[model samples]
Target chain A: MSQFENVSVVKQANVYFDGKCISHSVQFADGTKKSVGVVLPATLTFNTGVPETMECVAGACRYKLKDGDWQSSRAGESFSIPGNSSFDIEVVGEPYHYVCHFG
Target chain B: MSQFENVSVVKQANVYFDGKCISHSVQFADGTKKSVGVVLPATLTFNTGVPETMECVAGACRYKLKDGDWQSSRAGESFSIPGNSSFDIEVVGEPYHYVCHFG
Candidate 1:
């Protein structure tokens, strides 16, 4: 996917996950929150409070939706995870650059 | 700083610094490159080819311009690095969150 254009950023925040990942949160004018983060070569499970759309800005990863099959996403690719559910993401070698949008 | 704001992202890129820092590069609609990144708790020096204005998005870090004073900047703060010069950034407790503007 391309960059997010014409976005009004309101606030920024940092998220820590021990030494696994650190995501920088971006809050926009329309009350939407997005995070640009890097996930190292590890497998992680994330629980979302809101529906999230994750875009692979760089690198690649594999994911399995709740009770679904594992799929892969590369640079400029995207996937959607339903809110209140969880998904598993696994990465290898290169740390993945991701842009996550919550709605 | 709170968030970035209305931004049109044309492309997303990843920047690496060995293991010290990893930044996700956001290329905006007007051709500006802004990186939202995390600096591990280490002192690293960077050389810039263009004038850079760095905003502290989260945590804090100490920096000194070329032959300048060493100063600390917390979240919601910012510093500028001149073109063709270098700056030293030191982080101790927390990884510093930064938004760097390049011109």
Candidate 2:
């Protein structure tokens, strides 16, 4: 039940991969932005525009960075992706919940 | 783009109906709670313990409240459901984005 307090959140969701992934953008008072999102049980590839740190809030995901081996990240775990790069993520059984930090 | 300011948002999403509908809980400074959510293209039934007002933020939905006729609610429109009641919503084409106010 971790939450982001005293922040601004966009009402509309960002739906990707035909709704397999959905996220809401939140902005802090200091102008930092992050996304709280979920990836349904599916394997998907995502391209990053800026550097991002994906923190698992609940559930789990197995991710593979560009030219890297697959690694599992569960609740309380995290993985980073370089800007202008891409990654593949596979979620099974349950949804993958995450907080994505942008830089 | 409409946004909620100075609020707390739950990091984990509320996934319902096998991920057909997803929402994030948001709490205001005064303790009021709402959910920003999206319903994918599907027909789903939802039961409520408390009264709720569903405000469409994007896309559209045709809803039937209990024994009422099906009605359309698009962006900027809202529909209310009585406490201890159930409603059926059908979304087609694009995902239906909404803000659900509970009381």
Candidate 3:
């Protein structure tokens, strides 16, 4: 821990998905909030009340925006999800790493 | 830059899997060799001439040894493969994060 003696910021996790995914909710010094999560392969659905931007940081995934078609998204690809709606994700062959921004 | 004022360590990557996974090869102050790789869902093979202790840091995976059964590995789990042999990894429904320690 002393290696990071100068780093006062420690990442904290707020949610865990059976080790398949982990969400670390970060609150910046100015109190802005963002969540970074690592998602493994699987078909999972999420309901949101706040608009969110999901950024694929590592792997790939196909997401269906409510009644929308499943679109292909690769690493570094991103999509937006509306508030009061839900989205479905089909994790592809590899782990799908992502960061979600919410307001 | 000033955020990690106490952290002198900077992660460097020697391999990148199309941004699906990234490996940060860490060389300790004592000259130890280890590779930390985040693997997105994929079926990949690796050949190693040195012994490695593959530790799952985040996700899960199934690895098959030489003529061995496909064993399930989850988060915080690990398996060792002999030197000079190759192994197959079928990344399941998530990212397979790993830390490989070598001599």
How far does residue A71 in candidate 1 sit from its true spot (Å)? 3.5
- For model 3, the superposed segments whose C-alpha errors exceed 4 Å read A1-12, B1-103
lDDT of every predicted structure (CA atoms)? 0.76, 0.98, 0.63
DockQ of 3: 0.13
Task: Write model 2 residue lDDT over B6-87, tens digit each, in one string.
Answer: 9999999999998999999999999999999999999999999999999999999999999999999999999999999999
- Residue-by-residue lDDT tens digits, candidate 3, B6-74: 222222223344434455444454556565566666788888798778877666889998889999887
Give a tens-digit lDDT track for model 3, residues A4-97: 1122222223334444455544344455555556666678888988999997766788899998998988766789999999998888666776
State candidate 1's DockQ.
Answer: 0.45
Q: The CA-based lDDT of model 1 is what?
A: 0.76
Per-candidate DockQ vs. reference: 0.45, 0.96, 0.13
Candidate 1, residues B1-103, lDDT tens digits: the string is 3555566543343545644676656655666667777788889899999999998877899999999999999988899988999999999987787788897
RMSD of each: 3.3, 0.8, 8.5
Model 3, residue A49: distance off in Å is: 2.3
Among these predicted structures, which one has the highest TM-score? 2
Model 2: residue A3 alpha-carbon error in angstroms: 0.3
Candidate 1 regions exceeding 4 Å error are A24-34, A67-69, B24-33, B67-69
